[model samples]
Target chain A: MIVGDLSRRELADRLAGEGLALQFGPFNLRIRSNLGSFASLAHQLYEPYPLPEPAAISDFHVDISAPRGLRRWLRRQACFGIDGQLPFAPYTIEHAFPALEWGINWCVATRAHHLLLLHSAAVERNGRAIVFPASPGDGKSTLCTALIHSGWRLLSDEFGIVRPEDGMLLPIPRLIPLKNQSIEVIRKFRPEAIIGPSFLETRKGTVAHVRPPVESIRRAQEPARPRWLVFPRWVAGAPFTLEAMPKSQAFLSVATNAFNYEVLDEIAFRLVTEMVRSCDAYSLVYSDLDDAVNALDKLSQASDG
Target chain B: MLVSPLADRLIWQEWDDIYIVYQPAAAATHVFNETTVLILKCLQQGPLSMEVLRHQTEAALGVSQDELAANDFEFATTRLEELGLVEFVDDPSTAQ
Candidate 1:
């Protein structure tokens, strides 16, 4: 069953009562929430996701709800709890869905050490995937959003979960939260983008979420072998430039930028070295999205990884 | 005095001219330039003075030793010592 199959009342009821069991990529999350606002937004944004069996064991039991004490009655706030442990401070009540999204990402990135977790965005075309290792102001999510809308399949915008045993990228196509001005950028780029309500004064200044395309959500189980590592940045009025980076330098950047490079240790060294060796690495700078897209599309077609 | 490279404790990965060495004992990883890697390779034979290391590094990197090259050699070995990848040891011959 898909989330869209359920009515708003039914979705809310499932969330409040026994919890709503949903499959997010490889994870089975049984989300339990009592907040009406969170439920309404989640139902809208996650309508494309498939539901796991009600009796299936959940990898995580996540709670998004108002904190205890007078805070729940006055100037309301939301908190995230996983398996009875509150991992973060309370956010304003309206940021509950963002809290839920970010909380889930934290749970996976911190707990799932068995897989190589990279702070990157990945998208696939023709059985080949390109990974954009994320850094501050790198325009990773923006490029990922644009690519997915323009005929590429979205592997993920936040988590780059690679299976160490085989070096394949597992798709965890969740909500892509566009922050501040990027929200407007994406809206103008894709007029038909299914964005949830924008919440202001949250942690990331202002934020809005773009729902994953239904086709991408439906193909969540499909994993793609990574082919290219492109480090991208958006600079105002800069001409498009894509330059080859030395493999050793690429290794350092990718390893140091990973969320758990130290935790994995030798496995990280081996896999990262192999990944860089197998793929061509480049540094890209562009001001225009059209030029960026065309260049990447051309690269994907021109060479084999 | 001579410098000793702690090669026994390191895990080295090479791609082209650069090396990624992981010190499992310290749980630390470091990227080595060609010069640093060449110095470590030369020192693995035994502790060597800067004069001896300079000759070996020049041969390995295929460069003629001059003032600038010697300075770069000192810089590389200094970096190795800073990273605890190498240490100074008393030369046995001199002790005698």
Candidate 2:
């Protein structure tokens, strides 16, 4: 049964007990959290994801619970637990969803070394994926959310998992976290976009998550061959420009942006080299989302032809 | 004379003139330009003196020994050593 099939009470009961196993891209995560806000957000946001059967093996098991010690009673907070260890400090109860989101990303980034994990956004169209490897504040997620709403499938918003054996990009398809002004930008860009409540004064500054499209969630298992690697940066009032990036520069950019590039070592190098070699690399700067999306659409078409 | 060794677990790939070396033992990847890679390739054979490396690199790349700056070669070798790509080793002949 899909996660949407469970009633909110049922979902909460399962989460508060043995946990709820949900399929996320290629991995199945068993999440246990008693945080009421997290449960509500899951019911609202993860409506399209399939629920893993009771007997399914989970790749990572995590829990979110009330923090203990003097801080628990003094200023009540939530702590994320992974395999009996708390990897991060507690956050206020209002920021539970972001904490959970980040915790899941941490799990994949730190433990999943079998695949090359890039700190980037990935989207697919016409059976080909485009990877955006950029430093923070580069407007990757904003552009990614725009493209997804414009018809591209969201492969991932934070991590791009590339399988070394076949050079395929795995889809994580989780929430697209929007920070600060980008949240308002996306909200206005796509009026129908369902974004979670914004958590202000957090580490990332007014962070919210845009729910993944149902189609993306349904097609999470399908991997796409990478066709383009674009390093995008948004500058206000700037004319859109797309420039070719040298393969050598692209190689270093990708390696530097990868989360587990060092851990995967030889395989990571081979895979990233193959990826940069096969795809057209570019540096994209744009102010308008529509213009940016249109340029990418044309590029994808040119690639096909 | 400077002599260094390439790690055993390294896997090398060439893109144009750039070389990408993947060191599996350390789980680290390093990119080297053609000159740096050529020097490393020479070191892969065995330890070589600085003078020997100069002549070998000059011959391998068809460049004049006079045109090859000694400081640049020394700097590159030192950088490679810093990256753990190569290490100084005692020459058996020198010991004898």
Clash count list over all predictions: 0, 1
The parts of candidate 1 lying over 4 Å away from their true place are B14-16, B64-70
Model 2 chain A: lowest-lDDT 10 consecutive positions: A260-269
**TM-score for model 1?**
0.93
lDDT (0-100) at residue A267 of candidate 1? 83
TM-score of chain B of each: 0.82, 0.82
CAPRI band for model 1: medium
Error of 2 at A298 (Å): 0.7
> Chain A alone, TM-score for each of the models?
0.97, 0.97
Expressed as tens digits, the lDDT of each residue in A177-205 for candidate 2 is: 89999999998999999998889998789
| Residue A31 lDDT (model 1) | 93
Supply fnat for every model shown. Answer: 0.55, 0.55
Model 2 / residue A289 / CA error / Å: 1.1
